[model samples]
Target chain A: MKVVVQEALFDPWEEVRNYQQQNLPRGKHGGSVIFVGTMRDFNEGVDGISRMYLDHYPGMTEKHIERVCEDAMNEWDIMDAYVVHRVGEINPDEPIVLVAVWSRHRAMAFDACRFIINDLKHRAPFWKREQRPEGEHWVEGNTADERAARIAS
Target chain B: MKVSVKYFANMRDRMGRADETVELDEGATVASLWAKVSDEPMPENTLIAVNMEYTNTEEALKDGDEVAFFPPVTGG
Candidate 1:
């Protein structure tokens, strides 16, 4: 599995291609599955969301993200996985994060990919600071997050 | 017991630096260190992480722990 924390912009399509290419050597057995998370324009019906600030609790965040990735690896017969999340500032239509999974079958890839995103949302030490027209708001974690994390506990 | 305080994104800009590793007393709690070191309101709203878990300043600490403070992450 490969996990990267960077401050550069990524083309979603390019990222998917890279993941597919990297694991293509195992194409005889594992089928590649890709998941891309993109930025949305609207926020609670509010207009003028020019950009979003990417901030994270560093030490805790990297560890938790890696843990979730490792769990995905162990639970499935996956060949490889990649998680790349961009931090700093991002504009609308930018790629926020990407998680790609590969396995011999689609089921394993799909389930494991979903689990990774869910776990990261719930357990990872990261928060969303959305910048909007009115002001900046600290996004709150949801019940689903708390629920997903209990699996680890 | 010293924990390095690092900030990312806008918090970095506000703090005028990216990373700050500070030394504290042998038995300083997160809350107490916050009051002693944090001079400005933490860029309006911020999140604190102790060790490798998202935590609050009320959480206690042990030696050799790394404390990080920053704004919430908006990345998907």
Candidate 2:
């Protein structure tokens, strides 16, 4: 299990390769599921998002992510899970976060990956502010009701 | 008692500082601490954490605790 929080951009494919090389020798992982979250040029129908600034409570961010991944691992039959989130200023089209899970079967891998991403979205401590041509604005968060509705759908 | 209060994102911008130490009565809760710090109304959906854990406004605070307040998380 590994959780990383940094200001530098990371290569998702390289991260996966590194994880496989480091952990495959220890245990057998038949399948791997990965999710890469990227910054977009628009949000909530607004356009021209040139840059995004991500801020996190340093010590707490990593701990929260680790806890989320740990919960997923405990609930599912998975070998390992990894999460990496970027802080500082990021441009559109750059990756923001990555979540990967390894399991003996495809089913567990898929479910665990999804669970980690969803939980991270709702539970993590990172905040985002968007910079655009008009002005900079802090993006509002998804309310619990909205999250519940999304999960139900 | 004293608690280290930290602000992030817009909270920091609005407060014009990243962190500070505030004196409080013994056993003050997050809600009262927030009231003591900012004069304006707390933003809707604001999130609070105590000692690196997600906590509620009613949670009792301890001396030397690190309290963080910020807007709701918007990250993926």
Candidate 3:
């Protein structure tokens, strides 16, 4: 299993290439799955989002993200996994985070990818501050995120 | 003792700076700093991370600590 975390402005493609490998599914080892999260321009009838502030609990963020990956490894025969999350400052249309997983079979890869991303959404010690054209506010946590996390628990 | 108080994102904007060195009375706790800084109206959306870990405003703080005060996170 592999996990990476960094702070970047906005570069989804570059970050994705970092973890993608040619030998992903060699002997059916090619069950590769990827998840990309993009920032939206508008929210809740609000005009639009200019930029967003991504914050993380420095110490806990890394550890918690790793734990999510470890959990996936335990249930499946996953070979490798990579999780990259950027922090600092990010704007709309930016790629905030990416989770890539590889396994000998497709099922494990897809399930692991979904599990990792879902867990991170709910449990990671990160918060967002949205800056819309009209004004700004802290993006409230969604019930969906909480419910998604509960399933894994 | 003097500790490094870091401000990130909007917190940095509202605090008008990213970091500062503050002198705390001996035995100062996290609550004490909140009581002191909360009055500044830096920003309502700000959260505190003490010693590189996210912490509630009421948590205790000690000397030689590195605290980062910033807005909520938006990461995958």
Candidate 4:
């Protein structure tokens, strides 16, 4: 398991490839599930967001994500998990996060990947301040996980 | 006793400082710590962490502990 919280921009594909090469043995894992979250140009009905500043509680943010990955490991029969998240200034279309899970089969990989990302969205100690054409504003809250909400009801 | 209190995101702006050392009575809970720091009522969505771990306002705070207050997390 690996978790990285960085300010530098990263290539999600490269991260996935490197982690698999270094960690997962050849033919050891049959499938990998990867999820990448990117910044959108519009939010909260505001369009043409030029940039975004992500503020994170440094030590706490890492710890929280690590716990999420650890929980995924415990809950699923996955071989390993890798998570990379970007902090600091970001532009539209830039990848903000990457969550990859490897398992002997695709089912566990898919479920664990979704679980990790969903948990991170809700629990991580990170805040976003977007620079829109109108002005800057702190994002008030995250949108509900529609599928999860429906399932829980 | 004193605890170091940190604010993040909007809370930092609202508090007008990133961090501050706050005085508190022995066995003071997080709620009382907030009472000493700010005049505004704590928002219902306020999130708190004690010593870097998520906790409630009623969690007992110790001397030299680190407390953080922030709005609801909005990250992905």
Candidate 5:
């Protein structure tokens, strides 16, 4: 498993290729699932977001992501998983994060990929501040209680 | 006891600094640390973590603990 927290933009295809080359043996995995999250021009039904500034705890962000990946690995029968999240300033339409999982069966790959992304959304310690034409605002979403409820049900 | 208090996102902006070493009483919990550091009222739904793990305000603190406080996360 590989977990990365960086500010540089990444090529999703190149990342997948590198992960497979370095971690997976040929014919060892039958299926791979990948998810890329990109910065959008709008959020929370508000449009015209010009850019986004992502902030994270330096020493803790990577560790939290690794823990989330480990949890997914333990819950599924996946061979390998990789997560890359970008921080700092990001323009609209740029990639923000990536999650990929390799498994011998498509079922495990799909399930594990979903689980990792969902868990990352709830568990990761990253914050976003949006710059707009009018002004800047911090985006607020589900609270911890709401997140716990969603996970429980 | 000296505890490292780190802020992120808007909290960092509001505090005008990223992090600082705060002096608190021994056996201080996360809540007391937050009250000591933040001048403004703690925002609703602010998240706290200790030593890289998610923690509640009531959790007891030890000397040299790294404490972080920030707003709710908004990442995908």
Candidate 6:
């Protein structure tokens, strides 16, 4: 399992390809599931969001994401999981996060990938402040993920 | 006893600062520490992390502990 918190823009496909080439064994994994979350042009019923400032608790944010990835590996039969999340200022259509899971079977890969992304969405120690046309506002909350909520409860 | 308190996002904005060291009575819990710092009651869905681990207001505080307060997470 690997987790990276960075400020620079990343190519999701390149990250997946490189990680699989360097880390995964030959022919050992049968499937890989990848999920990329990107910044939207609009949010919370607002339009033309010019930019977003992503703030995080330096040490705690990285640790929280690492724990999320570890939890996913523990709950599923996945070979490996790599997560990369961007921090600091971001523009619309930029990738916010990447989650890739490799497993011997597709079912495990799918389950673990979803689990990691959902956990990051609801639990990670990152906050968003959007610069809309009106003014800057802190995002009150994330889009509700019932799966994450169920797991939390 | 004394503890370091850190605020993030909206909490930081509302508090008008990032972090500060606050003195607390011995055996003070997270709830009382928050009450000492802010006048408003803890907002709904507020998140608390003690020493970087998620915890509740009822969790007890200790000298040199790091406590963080922020709104609900909104990240991918």
Best by DockQ: 4
DockQ of model 2 vs. true complex: 0.80
lDDT by residue for model 1 over A1-153, one digit each (tens)? 778877899876787787677655743545666677766656766678878776766546677788888888898878778888887777888888888887888889888888887766555655566788888865554235455458668
Worst 10 residues of 4 chain A by lDDT: A140-149
Reference-based lDDT, residue A21, model 5:
98
What is the Å distance of residue A25 in model 5 from its true position? 1.0
Model 5, residue A99: distance off in Å is: 0.2
Best by TM-score: 4
Report every candidate's CA lDDT. Answer: 0.72, 0.88, 0.72, 0.94, 0.87, 0.93
Give the TM-score, chain B only, in order for the candidates: 0.79, 0.93, 0.78, 0.95, 0.92, 0.96
lDDT (Cα, tens digit) per residue for candidate 6, span A3-68? 999999999999999999999999999999999999998987999999999999999999998898
lDDT of 3 by residue, A5-119 (tens): 6775645566556555443444556577888887777766666788877776666688878878888999888988888787767777778788888888799998899889877
- The TM-score each candidate achieves on chain A is 0.84, 0.91, 0.84, 0.98, 0.91, 0.94
TM-score of each: 0.72, 0.93, 0.68, 0.98, 0.92, 0.95
Mark the 10 consecutive residues where model 6 chain B has the least summed lDDT.
Answer: B38-47
DockQ of 3: 0.32
The digit string of per-residue lDDT tens for model 2 on B1-62 reads 99999999888998999999999999799999989999987887788899998888999998
Against the correct fold, how does model 6 do in TM-score?
Answer: 0.95
> Which scores greater on TM-score, model 4 or model 5?
4
Measured against the native two-chain assembly using Cα atoms, what DockQ does each of the candidate structures obtain, in the order listed?
A: 0.32, 0.80, 0.32, 0.91, 0.70, 0.87
| Root-mean-square deviation (CA) per prediction | 4.7, 2.2, 4.4, 0.8, 2.7, 1.9
Candidate 2 segments whose C-alpha is farther than 4 A from its true place: A142-153
Cα lDDT of model 4 by residue, B1-75, tens digit: 989999999999998999999888898999999999989899889999999999998899989999999998888
Off by over 4 Å in 6: A146-153
lDDT of 2 by residue, A1-153 (tens): 999998998999899999889876555778999999999999878889999998888989899988888888899999999888999999999999999999998999998898888778887888898997789988877434465568799
Task: Tell me which residue pairs clash in candidate 5.
Answer: none
**Rounded to one decimal, what is candidate 1's iRMSD?**
4.0
